[model samples]
Target: MLPKKVKKRASLLAITLLVTVIGIFFILKSLNKNILYFKSPTDIKNNQNINFDKKIRVGGMVKKDSLIIKEEEIKFIITDFNNEINISFSGTVPNLFSEEKGVVAEGKLQDKTFFIADRILAKHDENYMPPELKDIMKKNAK
Candidate 1:
């Protein structure tokens, strides 16, 4: 026969474990709302029904000859080889932003595959040479 104290301690331990597990579950559920996902234009094109309320990052190359600036609003098309998505933003663009460059826009998609960007991030390659140009230079050097 087990002692009374031992049985009480075992029960208390079990309850504590259950409470800890439930606390962890709620913590993880809340944290999930803070996590944003990144996708490409092709991914967005394939999954057109994604929830628009949530924030996300979209990465792609700025399509050539697609940039249009009108007063405060700037519009461009981002392409991921397989698909292109039009983006519009009314804010100061990054200094490095230009046509045919790789960019990641943080925003949400609106109607008709239009991305309303809240922020635009443009990346520059090291050595002052763009990645595409660097690749060409490397091939020629070899």
Candidate 2:
């Protein structure tokens, strides 16, 4: 038979191990909930079995001349060169948000082509211009 002290130590160790596992499990589960996967319009177009119910982030450049402002909602198209996804946002957009700017919208996909945005994240830099815009300007300069 194991000594009394050894038995107590083993039981304590087992309890500690179990508690550690449970803690890790809860930590990972919570992290999973907080993780928002980013997808482009092309990715959505290629994935036919996407879960529309889950919240996700869609990143792309705003399509030119696509912004439609209304009293209740703002609508626009996000494009990834090959595909475009329409988005409807019912909140105030950032001041830097405009056509041809990079944007990432967090929302639930209503359908393959439509996204209802809960948040709009416009790409901004200290210089007030992203590299993409610089390239456009360079091209226009040529």
* Candidate number with greatest TM-score: 2
RMSD of 1: 7.0
Worst 10 residues of 1 by lDDT: 32-41
Best by lDDT: 2
In the range 10-75, model 1's lDDT, one tens digit per residue, is: 999999999999999999889863553467777777774788897788888899999999998999
Over 4 Å off in model 2, which ranges? 1-37, 125-142
TM-score of 2: 0.63
Clashing residue pairs for model 1: none
- TM-score of each model, in listed order: 0.61, 0.63
Model 1, which residues run further than 4 Å from truth? 1-37, 126-142
Error of 2 at 65 (Å): 0.4
On residues 1-142, what C-alpha lDDT tens digit does candidate 2 reach at each position?
A: 9999999999999999999999999998889735645788888888878887898999899999999999999999999989999999999888889998889999999998999999999976456678999899999999
